[model samples]
Target: MGIELAWTHGVYVLFVLGIILMMVLRRDTSLISIIGIAFLGLTATGSVIASVGGIFGSFIYAITELLPTILVICIIVAMSHVLTDTGVNETMIRPMTHLIRNATLAYWVIGIVMMVISWFFWPSPAVALIGAVMLPVAIRAGLPAIGVAVSMNLFGHGIALSGDYVIQGAPSLTAKAAGIPVNDVIAASIPLVIVMGVVTTVVAFWYLRKDMKNGMIAPASHNPVTSSVFSSAKVPLAPGIKRTLAALVPILFVLDVVAMFVFDLRGGEATALVGGTALLILIAATMLAHKQKGLEQVTTHLIQGFQFGFKVFGPVIPIAAFFYMGDSGFNTVLGEVLPQGSHGIVNDLGVALAHTIPLSKEVAALTLTAVGVITGLDGSGFSGITLAGSLAQLFATALGSGVATLTALGQIAAIWVGGGTLVPWALIPAAAICGVDPFELARRNLYPVVIGLLVTTIFAMFLL
Candidate 1:
């Protein structure tokens, strides 16, 4: 194990610490992140002019990587606004009022429902759909707004996004990186995913329930309509249109999910199905409400949607840019020229750790988990999956451990953190929709997710 930490690797660690500090302090680190990028670029290139250019380039790179997520969110928010305008959002929630009769039931139902939807359509779009429909219902049913946020974050982002069972995108990334069949990683991931999901969500539910009993969590009169974009100009609709659109909207999304499976769609294809459906729904619903004036109002909704998207997109850009540096693929795009043998700071540190650490199955499991968590800091959970897979293979060769289980364990850790549960930037979609602070939401998720990861790592030992 020849572990030589480079100067760039040390700076990367410092920046990561800086990021965590900002999150802990509830401060925005966009400026600090940009500064970090500039400094990294300067150190790597030994050129002031190139380093300055790298700052803008890194930001652009980050935006390009996250464009799909931004677009999906913008389109969904627009669709939701149109639904609200037509009174369809309210009508949709009306039927669910009976099903979620109390706070306890509401919490579980909201989480479970988000998980199911996210499994099919991915959590980025599911956050909007679930938040629009179920959040208000859960609030009305006596769940605290923050508790509702926690439930959705843990289940949708933490569990479903981490596992990605239906889509299997996460597993495929890990599998491909590890040079193994996708099915092996997916099959290996089941127990670990289940253990992590069950443990984290259950712990969260118990904590929330206890908080409710202790009056720490508000049980009633929780404000659900907290986001500005969601509080739009709602027109009183005739019962017929409200009923018709409300019924059709969910069916359309569900059919879209079904079509994804039937046609073997995944990744961008699945995202397009969701986003395209939302856009079409936005058009039809807006036209239904405005009729002759539909042309004007539809423009209004799109403008509002883009505004909301950009608002969220701004803070996200710098954070993502800093993290994207952790992935080797972005080294050339985001920064100045690097020295020979130096690439991604995070991957380099990961390699150093793997080489330096003592060879033992137990130690390797925990080490890989830590590496996955570190790699996931960049906010795109799937980006670090390749590193996890590669490290798993590396450790297996050294320690004779099972590659599949180690890879699976690393995948869970990465996805659970980067996929959105613990990272504030990644938690934006769920946190923004639920009208909670993303950092606070990430803080809330910290304990449950960490505990779940530790337990799941231990469980993976037997399999190995």
Candidate 2:
């Protein structure tokens, strides 16, 4: 060893460099990169034993910290499934179909529907329900499977879930990490989300318009009402009454939204109201399905809901863990055994860069946005957001920059990239549900998401 380098600064630089390389190369998941870094850090500290211990320690910490949140997500998804099996999902979409007579209108309508529902109940369940019902109609109306997937991914996952304005889930996480009020984060995120949404929607239309102009797309195979999934299964409600309820579903949802706004119920309260309404609809649908089978059917739906929830959230844990280590709040959860000298790698590196790098706030905002985009390559938007938020706080302090603006820029970038736009894995559910190719969806989303991120970033630099 040539006079072994200091573990403090050098280790941090190498760790960050590894993350950048992993993202640029688009290699395996971030979890793999984290493991590699952990080992490297261990070696730099001259202790293989310590590295092994740290890995296990980190794993344990992540599990404990995530359990409660994961359980909540599971319960919520389960409830949605119960609602779906009861035919409430169909009821919700039925009225919307009347307004969407053409492919162009269908795309925007579905996007809007997904966004609204997702803002309350979340995107996981919203995707399944929307895909199962509205997709076929959109397809028949002339929207391509790729188009539908893009709409759902952009609206539900990116726009709605990213801002999480109603439920405040995403904003709450970012707010907690930044030690700010959840309401403040929600209020701040609104303009940023709108800029991103408008840019993304416009770019998507531009790309889609090319396909439309070329006339290269084939119309979807049309199936008659009697041959459809709903037709095959006997619905619980009487035909006339069920149709009435189907009509009423949209009205109920609209009422929910109106009530939320009227009451000024911002976050968890809004989510609870939506969830409660969904539950009532679910019960009614179950009873209608066949009172005899309702109980068993509800159980089955819950199982499927849990399955889907785990599928979406499981891979996120380790990724979240690696980033969580960077935050002081979660540092102790990583285990108390680590030496006090083991500084947060992300903060330490950020501080080091702040001192050396000379840049205006505008430049720093852009840089932070780019960093968020780069970190998002791992394909978990929230993970990238968490990391970006932590880094933003560091950069804000060092440069005396606008913390909210930098944080919001990072929020926009991370969500645009990892929230199912550029990454194949992140787009998997929407693609699969829409019966489109995942890689193609990723490609379709590339230009629009990038342009949206750029526009929103520039807007943030000036507006905030």
Point to the candidate with the largest TM-score: 1
lDDT of 1 by residue, 240-306 (tens): 9889988998788778767977997766777777789889999998888888999999999999888
Superposed model 1: Cα runs more than 4 Å off: 1-3, 173-184, 210-234, 332-336, 462-464
Best by lDDT: 1
TM-score, every prediction = 0.89, 0.63
Model 1 whole-model lDDT (C-alpha atoms):
0.78
Taking the tens digit of each residue's C-alpha lDDT, what string does model 2 give over 269-358? 555565566556656666667589878876765576567555654554555555445433234533333345534444344334434556
Error of 2 at 325 (Å): 4.1
- Give the range of the ten consecutive residues with the poorest summed lDDT in model 1: 223-232
Q: Would you give me the overall lDDT of model 2? A: 0.63
Off by over 4 Å in 2: 1-94, 112-149, 152-196, 205-231, 234-237, 244-252, 262-269, 276-280, 312-333, 336-344, 360-362, 371-411, 414-447, 455-464
lDDT of 1 at 148: 82
